[model samples]
Target: MRITLERSNLLKSLNHVHRVVERRNTIPILSNVLLKAEGNDLEMKATDLDLEITEKTASMVEQAGATTVPAHLLYEIVRKLADGAEVSLATATDGQTISVASGKSKFSLQCLPQEDFPDLTAGSFSHAFKLKASDLKMLIDRTQFAISTEETRYYLNGIYFHAMAEGKALKLRAVATDGHRLARAEIDAPSGCENMPGVIIPRKTVGELQKLLDDPEVIVAVEVSDAKIRFTIGSVVITSKLIDGTFPDYQRVIPANNDREMRIDCADFTKAVDRVSTVSSERGRAVKLSLAEGQLTLTVNNPDSGSATDELAVGYDSEPMDIGFNAKYLLDITGQLTGDEAVFLFADAGSPTLVRDTDSENALYVLMPMRV
Candidate 1:
């Protein structure tokens, strides 16, 4: 295919789709991106069997054709080219090599036949809805950190998306957990999603979707089926296979009867936890929190390293209680809270502790305690 594309335009489209191409692939074609030029646009597509991304950009078309080339190599070449320079791509008559030219630089790259590229066939979707980019981003950012990385319990390796009744209204909820900690966030359910089926969006898909939601003004169209989910924004489309495992009933793990409450400055609490954990061992990284009538003390002790202790004045009026937790987990959950104060509800040192942002009612976190 012969086409001319602005360096910036080509680079932007490449950056979006090239990430789906694997660095090493058993099939040669899977390592390349399919490029098709027609009319006034050039389309780029890349896939790694489980996920696929396609994007289109305006280009000057000289000849209508298509070919496949190494995705990373092409991206690098376009990235290093002079800024604002126009890049021209023309395939050889033999259809085996593509000549790339920009200003004073020129190179030829070997290519595969376009027919060899596999097609990503996403079946009909049962549910389709539109949501603001900012809302979708909030749902992902609040819960993505808690997704489990363990391969054994595959169900926990992604974010569970479903519709649930919140008081008199139905809300869309995202929940993620790794056994030690769980994060839950919800947004008002969009129209036409009342009958949507629950789906487990894989971790990779969640990451890629985050990149697409960077523009706050953009509206994203989401389509879901039993086996796959698709997201479309403007001329870009991303399709991914949903994990087949069933997610456990997360409600059972959330503490229901915790009555003791404490509230502290979110930033101050995070900094204190970070400083005390410095002395903790790499494997354990546990920090002990002792809460009393009007004071909270954080301490960490390691056999090889010295101990660290810090105290903060908090609003705790219940009986004195002591709890141990992973310092990293505490920091991660605290980082997601946007308000100034973080509220914590505790039952005892042995039960799970519920945490929330005092100003936000839509998000909550549950962290299991560890023995100090």
Candidate 2:
């Protein structure tokens, strides 16, 4: 393939697809990116068996052809080139080496046959819908942090995406949990999405999708089937296989009868938890929250290190109660809040506590308490 592309444009496209190529691959072709030049655009594709990303960019095509080259090497070469420099890529007649030249620098990279690259087929999608980039990004950012990293309970390793009817209105929801904490976020369901099948979007796919949603003005096309899901934004397409596990009924885990209520500044609560947890042991960084009328105190005690305590004025009128929770978990849930204050509903020191942003009715968090 012979094509000339500006350094900035080429680097942007490379940065999008090269991340899908793994550094070490059992199959040599899997480590390379497939490049095709035709018409006025150059197409780049990279995959790691389970996930695939393809992107196209406008370029000057001198001779239309296709070849495969090391993804990381090409990315690095183009990245180090001077801004606005023109990069030319041409394959030798033997089709085994590709010459890359820019400015006064030139290098030849070994190439693999394009036919050796495996194609990730996304079967027919049963449901397709469009979502605003900002909405999709908010759903993921709110719940992805709670996805389980544990390999055994594979079902919790992704966000459960589905559509549910809330009264007469339908809502699209994403829920994630790691047994200790759970996060749920929902948005008004877009047209034609009410019948979409529930799917567990793997963690990696969620991360890659977030990158594509950086442009708030972009609208993403989402397609889903029983075994796979695809997302297309502008000229970029990402296809990923859904996890083959059933997500637990998350609705049952959210407590609906929690009585004790407390409202406090989200930022203040986060900072207090962070400071008190400094003296906590690494293994169990638990902070105790003592709530009483008009006052809340956070304290952490560690046998190996020391103890810390902090107090904050909050709006709590219920009877005095003390609850222990992981400091990190509290910070994570509170960090996602976009509003100034957070409301907490407590059942008891032994039961799960429900947390929510006072200004947002579409997102909720549940944290199981730990014994202090």
Candidate 3:
């Protein structure tokens, strides 16, 4: 294959698909990105078995062929070349190496046969729907942080996306949890997704897809089936395999009645936890929150590091309650709250507590209380 493309154009195309290329690969083809030159354009495709990203850039094609080359190495070479320089790529005599050229620089890089690059069979994503880019991003950003990193649970490692239509409205929902915390975010479903199966999209896939959804002006076309999902935007298509484990019924973990309610300004609450947690160096980074009669105090005590206490005025008229929580967990929940106020509904120190944005009931958060 041979193509002469502007350096900026090539680099721009490479950056889009770079994230899906795995740095460590057991298979040689998986470590390389497939580059196809023909028909007035060059296509770059990369995959890590679970995810695949394909992008194209306009190029002056002189020959029609495809080859695989190291993704990062190609990116670096194009990135370091003189700005606006024209880059020419041609196959070597043996067709086993690709010759790259720019101003005052030329190199031959080892290439793998394009026949060896595995194309993930998209496998019949028969359902196609259009979703707002902003809405999809909200679904991912709000819940991705709660996805579990522990692979043993297997099921909890991705965001659960499913369809639930209630009272004349079809709701698209995303839920994620690591057993200690959980997040649920939703958006109105576009037309024709009422029968979509619930799928657990792996965390890495969610992150990589988010990058593609960053454009607010674009709308993402979502195609899904039992085994995979594809998000298409512009000329790019990102396909990811769905995690094959069954996500536990997280609905049971969501508390129905937690009555020790407290309403506090979000900034004040997060700050109090931050200050009190300063002394909790050895106590598992735990901070205790005691609420009584509109008064809230945060306290942290560590045997080797002494203690810290900070108090804030809140809206609470319930029974006295003491709850323990991990500082990191507290921060993650508080960071997602966009408003100034956060409402905490608690049953007791041992029971799960529910949090909500005072203005909207659509988004709710449940945080499991820790034992101090």
Candidate 4:
């Protein structure tokens, strides 16, 4: 393809698309980015087998053609060129090499035939809707940390997205858990989104799609079928295959009846947990919380080192009780609290503890306690 594009505009689109390219590819064509010049725009695409990302940038097209070139190599070459430099690309008649040039530097790189590239089967989609970028970003930010890294329980490796109807109103929910902790958040279901099937969005796609949702004005166009989901916004489109296995029934795991309740400032509780857990080594970062009428104390003890304790005034009036929890888990959940106060509902030291921000009733987290 013969086209001329400014360095800044080209680099912006390349940065977003290149992350989908794996460091090593079993097939050489998978490593190259397919560039096409058509209709006053240059389109760039790269993919691993599971996910594909494509972006377009305005460019001056001298002739209509297409070719595949090394993704990272071209990115690096254009990155080193002076700011505002014009980049010219050409494909020779021999069909063997592609040439790239800037003011004084030139590169002749190997090319792969465009026909060899794999085609994504979007397959008959039956659903489409529009979601606010801010709402979509919040759902991912609150739950992605709880995704499991364990390969054996492959179904737990992503956030579970589904729609539920409550009293004739539909709610969109995102849920994630790693056996030890769980995060759940909900928002108003977008109009016409009540019928989309439940899907487990893989961790890699969650990360790549997040980068595209930063703009406040961008409304994500979502289309889904039985096997795949497609996200289109502006000149970019991303397609991903959903996990076929069923997700666990997360509703049963969420506790509803816990008599004891404690209210404390979220920041103070997180800081105390961080300080007391310092003595704990890599194996167990456990901290015990002792609570009674209007008083809370956090303590941690390690045989190899000394112990530390801190006290805070809280809003608990239940009988005296003690519970042990992983310090890291508490910090992660507490950090999600955007308001000044947080509430914890507990059954006993052996049962799960439920937490949420007093100002926000839409999000809730559950943590499994550990024996100290």
Candidate 5:
């Protein structure tokens, strides 16, 4: 292919598509990105077998053709070119190498036949819908951190998305869990999402989708089937395979009645936990919470190191009790809360505790207690 485009335009498209290519590939063609120049645009595509990304940008086409070249190599070359500079790409007569030029810099990249690039076939989609970027971002940001990393529970390695009928309205819900903790978020379902089948989106695809949703005002078109999901955002498109397994029923773990309540300043409680955990052992970073009539004390005791304690006044009038929790897990849930005040509901020291944000009604978190 022979094409010339502004360096800024090429770099922007490369940055979006090259991330899908793996650094090491058992198949030689999987390491390259397919580039096609036709009419007034150049289309670039990259894939890692499970996920694929494509983007298109305006360019000047001298000779219409297609070829494949190392994805990271080409991205790096374009990124280093001078700003506002023009880049030219042309294939040799033997079709074995492609020449790249911009300003006084020039380089040659090995090329593979474009026909060798594999295609991820997206069959007929059962459901299609449009969601505002802001709504989609909120659902993902709240639940992504709780997704399980263990491979044995393959189903829990993704976010489960489904539409449920709540009273008179249909709500689109997202849930994620790692056995020890759970996060759930929801929003009003869009018009086209009625009766859509539940799907588990892989963690890698969720991460890429989050990055692409930087523009809150943009509308994203999503199409999904039992096996694959596709998202179209502006000039970029991402298609990925869904995890093939059954996610356990998460509702069973959420506590129905936890009467003991404690309300505290989110910022103050987070700082206290961090301070007391300094003396905790590396293997068990547990911070014990001692709740009294109107005060709370955070303490950490380690036989090898030392003991630390921090106190804070809380809005708790429940019976006195002590509970232990992992300091890191506590911080993670608090970080996602948008409200100034956090409410925690406890049944006892042995049962799960439910946490909620005073400002947000659509998101909730459940954290399991740890032995101190």
Candidate 6:
């Protein structure tokens, strides 16, 4: 393929698609990106068997053709070119190499036959919907941190998405859990999502989707089937395989009857937890939280190291109680809170604690306590 495009445009499109290609691949063609030049655009595609990303950028096509080249290598070459420079890519007649020329720098990269690249065939989709970029980003940001990394329970490795009716309104909910903590976030259900099947998006796909949702003004089109999910964001398209395992009923784990309520500033609590956890041992990062009438004290003790203690005035009127939690988990939940004040509902020292932002009704968190 022969094409000429502005460096900025090519770099932007390559940045989106090259990330799908794995650093190492057993199949030779899987390591290269498929480049097709036709019409007034150059389409770039990369895949790692399970996930695929495709992006198109406006270009001046000199000859209609297609080829595959090292994804990261091409991206690096375009990235190093001077800003505003025009880049020219031409496939040699022998079909063995692709020449990249920009200003005074030129490089030739080995090419693979475009026919050898594998295609992830997305069978007919069962459901399709459009969501605002801001709403989609919010759902991902709030729950992605709790996705389990354990390989045994592969079902919990991705955020669970489904549509549910709450009171009189329908809501689209996203839930993620790592056995010790859970994060749930929801938004008003967009049209065409009420009867969609519940799907577990893989962790890597969630991360890549999050990065693509940087523009708040764009509208994202999502298509889902039983085995695969596809996201079309502007000129970029990402298709990924959904987890095959079933997600557990997360509603059973969310505490709904915790009576003791403690309202504290989210920022202050996060800082206090971070400060106290500094002295905690790496194996056990437990931080003890003691609450009384109107005071909350955070303490971390490690026999191998020193101890730390921090106190903050909170809006608590319940009986005194002490609970231990992983300091890192606490910080993760608190960091996602958007409001200044956070409410924590406690059932007991051993039971799960419920946390919610005082100003946001769309998200909630449940934390399993750690014994001190």
Model 1: ten consecutive residues of lowest lDDT: 118-127
Tens-digit lDDT track of model 6 for 1-372: 788999999999999999988998888898899999999999999999899999999999989899999999999999999999999999999999999999999999999999898889548899999999999999999999999999999999999999999999999999999999999999999998979999999999999999999999999999999999999999999999999999998999998899999999999999899999999998999999999999999999999988999999999999999999999999999999999999999999999999999879999999999999
What residue pairs are clashing in model 5? none
Candidate 2 per-residue lDDT over residues 2-40, each given as its tens digit: 999998999999999999888988899999999999999
lDDT of 5 by residue, 1-372 (tens): 799999999999999999888899999999999999999999999999899999899999999999999999999999999999999999998899999999899999999999999998557888999999999999999999999999989999999999989999999999999998999999999988898889999999998899889999999998989999999999999999999988889898899899999999999999989888888888989999999999999999999999999999999999999999989889989989999999999999999999999999999999999987
Candidate 5: which stretches are off by over 4 Å?
A: none
Which segments of model 4 are wrong by more than 4 Å?
none
**Lowest summed lDDT over 10 consecutive residues: which window, candidate 2?**
117-126
In model 1, pairs of residues that clash are none
- Give the Å error, residue 41, model 2: 0.5
Deviation in Å, model 2, residue 228 alpha carbon: 0.9
Instruction: Please identify model 6 stretches exceeding 4 Å from their true place.
Output: none
Alpha-carbon deviation at 271 in model 5, angstroms? 1.4
Instruction: Give the TM-score comparing model 4 with the true structure, all chains together.
Output: 0.97
In candidate 4 the C-alpha lDDT for residue 79 amounts to 88
- Model 3: which ten-residue window has the lowest total lDDT? 357-366
Output the worst ten-in-a-row residue range by lDDT, candidate 6.
115-124
Candidate 3 lDDT (Cα, 0 to 1) = 0.88
TM-score of each: 0.98, 0.99, 0.97, 0.97, 0.98, 0.99
- Give lDDT per model, in order: 0.95, 0.94, 0.88, 0.89, 0.94, 0.95
TM-score of candidate 3 versus the correct structure, residues matched by position: 0.97
